[model samples]
Target: MIKTPSLREHIPKTFADIPETTAYEAGYLVTKNAGWRNVRPVIDKDKCIGCLQCYLYCPEGVIAKDGGKVKIDYDFCKGCGICKKMCKPDAIRMEAEKH
Candidate 1:
């Protein structure tokens, strides 16, 4: 009879011991290359009320307070969609980044 490995035995002891990339990682790379574009937060100046809500909620620090309105740094943004979700005025919208 075949036996399945226990969950405890399947986990790695240390982070370094784990493989550099897993199958999921490879799949993500494939999807990313195949136009699985990331979402970037775009702030509509007219809709934005200069509340800094997006800047405060962005965990990635991609949102910055510029003068009074908020601006997103697309280069560092991971497209987590948090900023858009947290916007009180719905000023932020997630748009697909062009590759």
Candidate 2:
């Protein structure tokens, strides 16, 4: 059986627990940057083919496989549309952030 690590396991316990990263890096580490997002990606599960294209192209590495489907971790997602663009099935779409 394939074992997947729970998202909780990756949460940082404190400020010191956050991994050090360079500004040049494309993604954030366990930090909730949703406040900075102007748009967010919403996945249509029914249209998803589970091809992993979105997962592979997500620059923030926020896309994950969930039971043969794909999910985006909005906390770290920077609202980039790479996932939606890479989604061949048109499963992902970007919408304006409500807040």
Best by TM-score: 2
Off by over 4 Å in 1: 1-37
lDDT of 1 by residue, 6-96 (tens): 9999786753444332222222332232234377778889898876666667775556555556676554567888878888899888788
List ranges where model 2 is wrong by over 4 Å. Answer: 1-30
- TM-scores of all models? 0.59, 0.69
Provide the lDDT at 15 for model 1: 39
Q: Residue 54 in candidate 2 has what lDDT?
A: 79
Residue 59 in candidate 2, Cα distance off native in Å: 0.6
Candidate 2, 6-94: lDDT as tens digits? 99999967534543321224343545666899999999999998777777677877776667776777777889799888988898889
lDDT of 2 at 22: 17
List lDDT for all candidates, in order.
0.64, 0.75
Q: Which numbered prediction scores highest in lDDT against the true structure?
A: 2
